[model samples]
Target chain A: MTATTSEPGLRPVQKSRYKRRSKGRGNFEMWSWVFMRGSGVLLLFLVFGHLFVNLMLGQGIHAIDFAFVAGKWSNPFWQVWDMLMLWLAELHGFNGVRTIINDYTEKDSTRWVLKTLLVVSALVVLVLGTLVIFTFDPCVDPGSTLSQCK
Target chain B: MTATVEENTEAKPGAVPTFEVTLRIERYNPEVDDAPHFEDYRVTVHGTDRVLDALHQIKWDQDGSLSFRRSCAHGVCGSDAMRINGKNRLACKTLVKDVNPGKPITVEPIKGLPVEKDLIVDMEPFFQAYRDVMPFLVTTGNEPTRERLQSQEDRERFDDTTKCILCAACTTSCPVFWNDGQYFGPQAIVGAHRFIFDSRDDGAAQRLEILNDKEGVWRCRTTFNCTDACPRGIQVTKAIQEVKRALLTNKF
Candidate 1:
């Protein structure tokens, strides 16, 4: 039988075969990790408050209608609250799904395609949601019976 | 007296009973076999026998071709670590009875690293990760004439992580490490934790910077597999969390 041994001074596994996209570029991952924790805590409050106000305070889920939403948006406090919730929840969820994709996807092409679709969808939702909040017209409906429409 | 002596030679009343255990070992001979497969060997062993003993029986009596790495069969050498009953464990440390000897015990090489032969893997990658973390004390300034002094509390700070044997059990059990070979794995993080929390080490910043890379501690999903697989019970997941917290707070 022939005796054999591994070569001397083999390269570190991380450096040898696997391709790393980020070149140790400043603490982006650190910040991403920090963002996950921070955004998670913030989302708890924002999400719970949104649910409490929308579903529990005064009128419950049945009270939620088009006019009810318009009335809430007409107020600056509620608009800012909804906008914060929208952005934070969307971005927080986006970053989360992005992390999942990064963890699971093996091929670079698969990661790129998934992340691209994620970014595009997130951008569309954020832009559309923000515009809807800012430029909301309660009087747009001709059959509206709200006091603001008069 | 003659009858008692013969009976004593036959079977002692309190002596441990022996049973036959079938070990289903994953075998791969790169020279011959294209893919890995399981081969069973039945061995009669005492209740006190370890998995290593069963392996030795198979190697010596049944199949001379069975190959495995082992040293200090009592488990200190960190060799002979493999998947026993689907869990990462040192064969020398795992008692056959503890692994449910009633059924077949599965012995396979730890995952993630390339399998070199039956129950042996290319540990270079695992060691490479360990080395990248700088698993040694880094001190600045001239060597002191006297040994550096540390308080009891300071010593206890990183006491848990100092028990790492580098068996690759914790790293192999990690799903993240299994999927992404580039991620620095839990063993590397535990190695960094060993020195990062050391009161005397001046290399915390450099090591922390190394771990702060994209493939660093950020990839840890807090699955606790490393913690569970740790033979030394080093609280692997907690150490990783502490390192992550240190990265955020810049304090150890």
Candidate 2:
């Protein structure tokens, strides 16, 4: 068990030496540092605004009924906003996860299985989430011609 | 003591100045090859140079067309990840001393993805998996006037998970991915785990549903390659286990 140069708490150096094949010299580490701060900064806005608009402002949390969501989706602004949030947060989170996966598993088989599952799940979620956001129909009141979803 | 050549062993006869190491690397060419093959490179090398430096030497002196990915020449870019001596590693971060130990170090592209060249594997599938996790926090509560009102403990839950860098080292080194390319893999789970453990996120329920599918978190066997190969030391298997625990107990 050797001491590590990474953050002292996690024993980063030991992990870096497990295979200890070649000189990586902290390239991925540097990019990861940049990514965390960049994504963290972006997530601050995306997460905060998402909360404020969905819960605090205007009608507040209780106003978030099905019809309220439909009404919000009626505007392109909210659509784009939610879209951006979904893409950014999901991508950021996924990359963050990739980092985690690389860190923990020690077996080749185990790592592959988990990562394969991750990619498939991410694809499914992105496809389904995008579809739901774009194709949402708000009104169930088909009998009345009040507002046509079309 | 007299400093004479007769008494010095530094000039000992038959002392080899260099050693030749055998590198059994996987080779692939989209134009000429249907599958990859192991090509051996016997290099007369200095002990101090890293494997990446050796690769650089190969590309520079032996074969300019010996393709591989490298940027930042350091471990941060995650672009130069490869399989070395049966383990995943960032080429730039790996040193020859550690891998060879007076032997040759084998290098190959990461598995679980399509190979682009000698040591470069496709990352689109890896990134595609990352995009699926709905990785951001979704809250329907009042935001604090400042900093979103997360307790230190709550923030700490996701803190360790926040260090990931989509390098594909863990995913490619995995054996399961070598067999089945469709698996969600560790990186995605790590990403989901970041949000799953986040106290402020309301999407845990939804994310759990996504992870509980047939090809979900249950697939992990806990080999710890992700942990071993992770340049960042994230405890990826533990996070996956946590996610599995969350799935079993209705708690994120």
Candidate 3:
């Protein structure tokens, strides 16, 4: 009896069918990973500061009325700080959730849908948050009794 | 052929204490079965027998149709990696008693690979990933007059990743690999790490570039499943992290 030959396996030079696409998005994933770490550290300080000032300093949580926000945003430093916090927090959260979506969603179409929804929601929050931080009016209420409103 | 433990004990009075171990193995015959199913077999095994031994007993005495792979009957060959009692382990390395022989031990093929038979998976994909990383050292320039030398400290940088035996245990245990087979799993990253951090290898840039793909090192979520599943105790996740760090710093 004669022995039959089997097909040869992949050679060292041959790429696997499962290999990631060669035309990669360059350093996008690496930069995203770095962004997560960098933004995470910055978020720690920004979030803690925001919390300490709003919930601990002055009259504490009771002092966080609309007038307080109006007074804070009226200053350029507070405006810049709040804007940075809003942008960093939104992008950080969006990137983190995007990663989760990519990890869990196996189908490309499904990932596309979820990611589209994620981007849309993130955009809405970011735009609204930025708008609220910058365009907030202290005297929007006509009958306001606060000195700043007067 | 299916003898009770008491019968076996009675047959050999002074023999080592033997117990009946029921191995519930997930079996699939592509030629016959439409889907994979579990099949149980009772084998009388000695106190010191490994899971591989019980499998052999079933194949030799009770069911000749049972198929599995085993080489060296020790941990070095890395050919017998399977899911033993819900965890990825080498059957030859896992003792029957160590895995609670009182309950039926469940043995199944490793995940994320095409199961070619009962306990054998088509390891081509795993090997492909390994080969994709260029596991061997690559050198450029003229050959050294003597073998390239390195300090002990430099050698130890990647020593932890050198223990990998390409078992596929670590890769198969990964949830990311399970969800996306395209992702170059932990084993490939370890394979790359073995050479990437090597002071002598000039292939770090190429291998790191390959791993920078979307489905490459970035796909790893630091789940640590690979580290826990490694039969050789290699720090699989740490190697992956080092690779990621190397990519970030452009310094291996």
Q: Using Cα atoms with residue i matched to residue i, what is each candidate's TM-score against the true structure? A: 0.91, 0.56, 0.90
Error of 3 at A18 (Å): 2.7
Error of 2 at A147 (Å): 85
Worst 10 residues of 2 chain A by lDDT: A3-12
Compare the candidates by TM-score and give the number of the best one.
Answer: 1
Task: Give TM-score values for chain A, per-prediction.
Answer: 0.84, 0.73, 0.83
lDDT of 1 by residue, A23-105 (tens): 67588888877777888888899889989988999869989988899899999998899899889889889988998998878
TM-score of decoy 1? 0.91
Off by over 4 Å in 2: A1-150, B1-20, B42-46, B141-145
Name the candidate, 1 or 3, with the larger TM-score value: 1
Clashing pairs in 3: none
lDDT of each: 0.84, 0.69, 0.84
lDDT (Cα, tens digit) per residue for candidate 2, span B164-236 = 8778887766655444455568888999999988887889988877776544565566777788878778888
Q: State the lDDT at B139 in candidate 2.
A: 80
Per-residue lDDT over A1-150 for candidate 3, one digit per residue giving the tens place of the 0 to 100 score: 111121112111122445565576588888888888989999899999999999999889988877788899989899999988989999999999998887778678999999999999999998999899889888888988878876
- Point out the worst 10-residue segment of candidate 2 chain B by lDDT: B1-10
**lDDT of each residue in B20-101, candidate 3, tens digit only:** 8899998888789766788999887887788999999999998898889888888998999998877899999988878887
For model 1, report DockQ. 0.27
